[model samples]
Target: MKMCRTAAIAAICMCGSVFAQEQDRKFEVYGFADLNITKYWMEDNAAFRGLRYDDKLRVDLSHVNTYFDFRPNGNTRAMVELSFQGDPVANRSTAGTTVYTVSQGGAVNTVIGTLPLPAAGETKVSETQGTTLEGNSKIRALEGIVYDWGSFSIERAWMEVQFNDKANLLAGKFITPAGVWNVDHGSPVILTVKQPFQTGLVSIFPKSQIGIMERGRGYIGDVDLDYSAYLSTGRIHNTDETRNSLLIETPKDLAVGGNLSVNFPVASGLKIGASGFSGMQKQEYRQRIVKVDITKPATDAANEAAGLVATGKLDPTGIASYIQTKVGEYVATQALNPDNHSYDDVMKAQARENVFGVDAVLDVKKFSLQTEFNQQRIKNQLKNDSLTKTTGFYGLASYKIPMGENARLTPYVMYERVMQEGADNNAGTFMSGSNTGTPGSVLEGFQTYVGGVNLRLFTNFIIKAEYSYADVLTQGIYKDHETVFDAGALNIQFSMAF
Candidate 1:
């Protein structure tokens, strides 16, 4: 009897241990898949349209995202999100094909051959002599379209150690802490098919980073405040034009930034915030084989300076001019010498970049409105040695439809404008050999209009269709180019989450 009782006790203890283990551990798995198909239309004489008048469709697996969340206890949690995302970098014509190189003064479009991929010892060039591609039907993949599974990438992996109700520490590769889009980038959550240029092209902040962040929330007399700050691996790597990659590697230097915000009890669901960052980024510029004669002056002023130095009494301005002349000659000799040059040479430099922004969101009942404005500056990419300060903003408004039950719809519209100094208009023109008035010949920026409707079927599925119109701002002789005109595009998407 004693032996039987001991055996029973052992079994009960084991069962209790198993029960406790089950109580302490929890795991949840969920995911979403999103796809987008886009079509474009443009005028016959428009300077350059990405897919003008072509019935061909552009299909993208925008995101196939999977998430795993684990909780060992009340104070600890971990999450990981893997995404199979379509490659945006592959949106260019194939190497060795003809493509438009530039648009002149807004009126003239220049076309050129895509330079062949260089061999082991040869140099690769971006432009040559050729005709523009006829249509946008070819899809890039390892094989044909049958094998073009998009990149399986780790989009987010992070762990959180919660100390209390108001504080937590998180670390790992994560979405950026600032910006509304950065926080709500999932397909089921975002309302638009395309990301705004203000948050993407014009913002100096990176989309994601490997870092550590301190986040917390507090209340003051019923008003609430939320804050986050992070130190992350900086932007260092360059896009390997030779081969595309899903993840950038070998981050150098450091990037530090943070966000602070307050929620007001003055109104329901109203919040305002500001964010800022400063860092040094490694910039890569195209390598060109510039032919320079040391005897020839790069600027007429340089020649005058040299002559003044050879003549008479030196003033501070003259001395400075003389130094500039000598430096110019030295740089030309070092950079333009044919024997030391390669078309594949990427000139790398560390440029200081600064960004600041403010945002507000108002959510009331079925109506939601949000807007953000950002200004960013980067060193030494534009003319006259001045910082290229880009200014941009976007305003979005959405209204949820009043459906009875199990069905929901939301209609939304957004307007965005982003202006960058000396950026390409991408209108499908080659601006070649046309530097008449300005030191650089590229166009300035773009403005866009977007409208869409989102439909939710039951709880797990979402359907979206959107239309956009874009206009390019051009300068110089190609400015009036008939082809450099406005463009309209349509995008449709379906998404599911569980």
Candidate 2:
């Protein structure tokens, strides 16, 4: 027993020595954040646009890096970062759900607070149900930290093992490196409000599934190549639930997908690259209601009346050939259930075809030509709806005109077309609410032609001005619309590494 106690004391001494040694290590820090305020003149009832949409301002107050990046001996080091932001503005609409003329008209869902929808657009829809998670229309503060071990996966829980040259295992809630937008770090001044077509909107990562990603730099003979294979359980966040997009977000929901890219160095000062992704993404959604005029066929209306009489008025049970059972009555009675309100009581299967994206950049002297394109096949289980196989694409070309020594001016033109969903259903509005039937105030798909010029002075301050015109896509009578909006800004940033 005496010998055992002595050994235990020795072990404790070793632990104390190790702790003392760790106290000798050191850490490094860097990164910056700023604040920006903006005011826009958007059309009244115009489909709502956001920071990355038309012209919006972005702000950042705090972002720092603190990590013990220097190792004592081994080729190993540890690093961590805590990012922060103190700016937030809601992009929600004034129109949610409204009880239109409740003097005993059509079926009444419930009597909650009423919000008036626009007269020109479809009636407002209510956000009845869906998954719930803390979200940010604009980043407030990022309390997340990043850790790196042995330099495997540079970020997140994924690791870049040394066994393979250009292979990595990516997991955790990490951002997808899909486009040129600087989402790895969020700053509109650095990242264009209108990201390239290949990259998704500001809030969306191309693919941020909580799964594994195997990516690395490799080669196809002398051509030289880089590829990534990813499998994840995730879905794109449904920002506008009232829209006709296929939404199936739920817990236990998984999305498995992958992306591949190949880069070819044609010659000195000349290189080209391409990449794509495919996967199964599903989201379970609640009911989406817009103020839709139900012009039932004479026979259909007669059948509804008969069912109403048979089932009693309080629970009028009607059945259309397409809409089976008494769905309206069932939901009207149970729409507010904590866990029971949904288009389908059970989790429905909705899938979005992995997007096929490609971009090309040509290097010429100090200037470059960059063009990006993407095609999304929004696959839905239920067909015959006009919203099948919708697509969107944008193409822009700019020339960096060098002026004198410390300044450059870039003037560019772009053409973008976003196909509207449910095209056949006139007055078919994309509601932002669930089952409330109110149209979301924002519309994205339109033939928006943009022309802009950006001027940079002393490589620090940049001023970008753009003018856009569009024909809003909707059943509304407004057409051939034209509006002009622009922005001018000044910035200062500096970063040093040790």
Candidate 3:
């Protein structure tokens, strides 16, 4: 009986120890979702003829995110975020053929005829007994559905280790520490339905990076200072090149970036910050080259040589020599055309990019103000090296009016401007174009005005409505002409956080 009682007490103690360990480990699951209905329109200008969006009303499941945060011990924490996005559209590529008329000196090569080079890189050379060559051409076509479907992606997955009050180590894929808007980018958290020009439109800094970061905070009298420094894989350009080809490549070098900010705890809140990023972007354009068999064409040419010999125009012994010469010339021509070979890197361009941003925010009583400015410069390292520059700025202000104990109404207004040199500016449109002329030599500008109101019905739910107007102008030579584009949109969104 004493042994049984001791065993029961021992089991109870073990249970208590397990419960205490469980209490020490902390886990949290939280996320936010938002849906938007938008009405959009644009003037029928020739310059904006090929714009992606049309004048119509649309409903979109804009953002859905789920986050997991776990802390197994006092010094370590892990976080993961999953984002649901619109689905990709189905697309099909149609085969095409391009015919080339080869002419050595001033006369066309009648023996080769017109060579039909298909998009797949397969070519056929047919010889005809004619003085003139016929040309045939077919354009490549791509067709896809108009609407996007639903998809899932991982937004952030990272682990953080706390060394002390003044230092912490973070590793994995994390959001880049840049401006205020990018850090608090959730729909439920941001004040406006649309993000600022710099943060969302012409992102001066990359959205995320994979690497390690060291961040900490310190106090100096009444002032507080926080800073972050990181080394990451940097930004990638021409990402679609790999998707279109069979070859895969990753960035060969690392990028370094950092940010610093100062905050004052007076009134509601006040903060000022600056950020910078520098990296080298490498791109290689490649295309697939299908090998073609020249045996049939060479045989036909040799047969023609035999017919000439039968007509007393050549000797039978020269037939072998004729075939060999023809085959050699065909091989030489294929060598000159890189497309005739398989897996060729057609062109390579390398550029170094530097970006800088400054931001400030102030809150006093029910009134708040926020503003930011960002600039990015790209320098081409190849021949005809030139520099291209892009700049963006925005100012926002809002005022809150109390509605009830757990509800409030906030109205806000914003003005933004973005400019690019030596390129066509497509800010806020989610499209980018190559720079032309001398870098930083052409002038392009975009301006936007926005007004909105937010109704916080509950602590974790909000309704927002906004109207925005945009004007764009380009003063550079585009096929030898100037261009302008203007548009407007009305958006209503429902956002919730849990």
> Which candidate achieves the best lDDT against the true structure?
3
Candidate 2 yields a Cα-based lDDT of: 0.40
Candidate 1: tens digits of C-alpha lDDT, residues 37-82: 9887776665444322343588876776767778888998899997
Deviating ranges (above 4 Å) for candidate 2: 1-29, 32-39, 49-159, 162-164, 182-193, 196-207, 220-222, 236-253, 267-274, 279-349, 382-387, 401-409, 421-444, 451-471, 474-477, 480-498
Ranking by TM-score: 3, 1, 2
Which ten-residue region of model 1 has the weakest summed lDDT? 136-145
Number of the top candidate by TM-score?
3
Provide the clash count, candidate 3.
2
lDDT of each: 0.60, 0.40, 0.65
TM-score between candidate 1 and the true structure: 0.65
lDDT of 2 by residue, 1-498 (tens): 968944743443343221234445543333332333334446543454533333344333222222223343332333333333232221234433432222223334333233333345442223322211112011010011122211211222232333366755544444554543423343323322234323433222343444666666777766656566665654444333322223334443445444454555653233344444454444333433222222333564464564522333322223221121222332344434555533432223344444555556565554555555555554443332223233555666676788989777777776666554532221212222222233433344445566666566654345555555544454343445433222222222221111
Off by over 4 Å in 3: 1-25, 45-51, 87-150, 236-238, 242-252, 293-342, 345-348, 424-443, 476-484
TM-score per candidate, in order?
0.65, 0.53, 0.71
Better-scoring candidate (TM-score), 1 or 2:
1
- The per-prediction CA RMSD against the true structure, in angstroms, equals 15.7, 14.9, 12.0
lDDT of candidate 3 vs native?
0.65
RMSD of 3: 12.0
